[model samples]
Target chain A: MFHRSPIQSFARHGMLVLLCVLAVFPLYWMLNSSLKNESEIFTSSIFPHKPVFSNYTYAFTQMPIVRMAFNSFAVSIMMTMLQLATSLLAAYALVRWRFRGKGVIFAILSLTWLIPFQSIMIPNYVLVNDLGLNDTLLGIVLPFSVSTFAILSLYQSFQSFPGVLIEAAQIDGMSDWSILTRLIIPNTRSTIASLGILQFINAWNEYLWPMLIAKSMNHAPLQIGLRLFVNSDTNMWGSLMAATTVSCVPILLIYLILRRQIVDSFVRFGIK
Target chain B: MSQSLDNTIAPSLSGGTIIVRRRLSKKKLRRFKPYLYLLPAVALLSIWMYRPLLYTFYLAFQKWSMVPGTSPVFVGFDNFEHLFHNKSFIDSIGNTIFYTVGLLPFSILIPMILAVVTDRMESKSKNFYRAMFFIPMILAPVSVSAIWRWLFHPSNGLVNYLLVKLHLIKEPIAYFSDPGFAKWIILLITGWKMIGFSTIMFSAALTSINREYYEAASQDGAGSFRQFVHITIPLLSPMIIFMLTMSILFSSQWTFAYIDMLTTGGPYGSSTNIYYEMYRFAFSSLNAGLSSAAALLFFVVFGLIALGLNMVSRKFAFYDN
Candidate 1:
């Protein structure tokens, strides 16, 4: 708590500034490099002497980044909605009911969290291909629709909701649907929001699965498109920077707009 | 809705038996309602997760070329035998360990120090620095690999340019192409992306420590450094150990994208980890059996570690004064 000495404070600020530069430099590089032309990119200059908008136009016209971004959005949005729906139903069932096999079910669900997606990835790929779903957004979205992470997080919060309120609503002959919508979801709004944001971000940033699942740029997300762009044209660093920057906009915008919720979600899930 | 269904169920039933049967069926359905709610998640998990998990185990012992209409032939322990002698598999196992250990300093030690250094700062500036450090963690790995690749470009990149300009090296080396530097580059890229997440986690954990502990430490005539050494470290041990365990478990995984994107485990598998190796065996080589065997081995090993982590976290869950 003490930066009592003026010299100590200066050194501390100095180190912090350097670390900040290291942190922010790559991103700043991406932005500035996108503005540089092909010949200018090879130069060691930090900024372009004559900046151009051609790279951005090239990103849109020369590549399928727009389609890829649309695909990424659709998959992430569907994945988020599906995860939320399944998690809400499952969490409510786990918390509100006195049922048989609850412990076994919970154990089974939590065990899925232990198995990383990579271990099961090969089979999912083969299965998706066999089902003729490869290169379809559905293949990418289906396997991850129900997340134990979401269910478990919601289960914890749902357990905290007043049981007396639930019971009162039930006694008034309200159905479970109305009770969940009226009584539960409204009360635990922030938890649901944090979970939704976490899920959306995860789905948006997914790389390996989509790479394995989708064969073309039509259904593959922006990350995959960027990879394809890089692999195809090795000398197009300027255009590649433009494409990467384009892919980054949605998540960056999400982080900027919902900073607190997104930060909290990362903190909460990163430890787990 | 319930009242209408009830009336429809027994409107013409004057006999007690018919009414009782209708009511009994309704009660049974009510009891079964929880399963209905749970069906979607349970079914999907079983299909995608549990089924594939069992299939991976089964496939581990089988020989399959993934040729159309050809079934997997059970060849007991052959895949495992091949795995034991496979050089890349063995190399990747070692690399995985190296990554887990190499990343420890970047993931835990540095972030802990950063979190501590910034812990007592004014909140506004604290958050700004935190956000700056956290920016990379939010970027896609493909983007990260692209950025780092440009910076480390062999002939005309910033890193080479800077090193040459500073007289570190005369020749611009191909970092990703050279075996010695390939894995290290992967490690650096992975660690660079990872620092933000760890810093944020450490900062979050620091915020949870009751400042009363620090006050109590100071009341005993302890200075700032002494308070950190005595109170802060001890209080933060749970989170520290938790992160340590996580880094060990996930370091190889966190670097997966970078390796796949930049090196492709290239220069004779110099930069490959088990995850990438498994990927290569399945996708490139089309040897599903080999990949499945590798995954089964990891599943067992990591499964045990996860169980231990859970028990350990539960043990340390209580952090109150």
Candidate 2:
């Protein structure tokens, strides 16, 4: 609030409103198309002439939309938990202990983050294949069981935790495990939760890895399943829209509910 | 107690004699506790990331067709030599450069402007605007592609209808397959998804800028624009540069799914980047050596860029605090 004018306000909000429409137009289009029939979908209409639920029904019943969505949800949950557990424990140790090679460990982890996962795609696929884990959810989640980014972000958060409280817990004859559970983790719950949500969303939105792993439609996550649908012989636009809409609902809902925490999490950990 | 026990043996030389004390060994278990906690993360990274990385490097030199029970033959730099002459590989590198440079405006410039313009809005309005912009960033890439695919559909898409109604063009363009438009469309979609992410980054950076600087600038007769140049630009330069680097590095990756969905590197390999081209080499062509060679090339080029960026950004960062 150093300066202001009514003209500036109008111009600012007007621009925002315009950009807002542009940002949301495609999603609005997807929803609108989902409500249209086969002939209606082929027409040049902004609004559906005859809205129908058959597209959604066909997507669910004829296709394995539910199974795919459930698969995504389950895999994301497993991935999030595994990543958080490993990252949290490691971050706590790295932060609380004065260990040899601490700086080396930190530098190495960040380096791993910089190396593009694409480079390892072939080897990871080979490893998973050789292990006979292909076409399984475990295969999809196995390679990414630890996230360097998560560990780094948690390290930063855990660094800011007050040392006196930790010392007090130690003086009270508490083990390191007890001190973590009783003092540090409870105090850092919000950070953990926000990071967990991020990891969860990342896992849910993962496309390339799951697509590579799930060699068939039966084992595919929502994104892979969506791809298979598009690649299928039938060019069912309405049902494709419906399937996409269904696939997006969980993430969209998570975004809707935890908007503030999500934004804060991104701010805390730079968007990758 | 350990110190007292040592003091009893030889008061003058206790410090040197305590070096051989076995009693201190009792705490050895606690010293390894940290490593115990770090085991899972370190082990997992070693197996999944570092091991595969070394394997990719090794595989780059070996010629193999991925056949079961077959051995790969060491072909030296033949894969790289072949890549140099290969038309698709050459085109993909050019497109990779195209995507990296193409995303700067969306990832940095536009977001910087949006954040500065709306920096002073009331809380309700600010959250409303932020929420709207962030919609695309959170959507799955496949979902985003599906939505864009519908909008740009040649026959029944809104873009075509809008173009005709406005008389911008007489006929609808098959934007994805047309060589003229495919790469540009991929760039556009990637930038669209990316704008919101960088906008939030800019907004957070802006809020962290101390309010006193703006007030001081105004007191000294600087207008809003002048304040932005003198104070805001200096403070935000680090973030801007960081974002610019990130976009340049990862923009092609962001466009990958869209390319796979819309173009499949087609109308005759017009839109394919290195990642897709490599994927094609690995799976479709089943040529592991060529694919690994390409992957190795990507890793080295980007790794050097990242190291260079770390030094440059560190030197340029203007921390107000």
TM per candidate, chain B? 0.91, 0.91
* Residue pairs in collision within model 1: none
lDDT of 2 by residue, A1-272 (tens): 53568897788889999999999888888888999998888876879988999999988875688788888988999999999999999999998898888988888798885667677888899889999999999999999899999999999999999999989889899989988888889999999999998888889888778988987767889899888788783468898898889988998899989999988887778755
Q: A1-272 in candidate 1: lDDT tens per residue? A: 55368888889989999999998798888888999987888888888899998999988887787789999999999999999999999999999898999999989987875677778987788899899998899999999898998898889889889889999999999998889888899988988998898888888888889888878887788888888888888888888888888988899998999987888888876633
* Cα lDDT over the full model 1: 0.87
Candidate 2 residue-wise lDDT, B1-321, digit = tens: 556666676556656655635545546667788999999999999999999889888889999987768878999999999888889989998888888888888998899999987788788988889888988988998898887887888877789888988999999888987999988988999999888888899999999899988888778989878988899889998898889788867776787888998889987788899989888898889998998999889888888888888888899878887
Residues B1-321, candidate 1: write the lDDT tens digits: 555655765566667657666777888898899999999999999999999999988999999987768889999999999999999999999989989889998888899999989888989989888888888888889888998898899987889999999999999999999999999999988888788889888899889888888878778889988987877777787888888778877787888899999999988889999999988888889898999999999988988987887788777655765
**After best superposition, candidate 2 residue B77: deviation in angstroms?**
1.1
Model number with the top DockQ:
2
Interface RMSD (Å) of candidate 1: 1.3
Q: For all the predictions, what are the DockQ values?
A: 0.72, 0.75
User: Which of the numbered candidates is closest to the native, going by highest TM-score?
Assistant: 2
- Model 2's TM-score against the true structure: 0.95
Please estimate how well model 2 matches the true structure, expressed as its whole-model Cα lDDT.
0.86
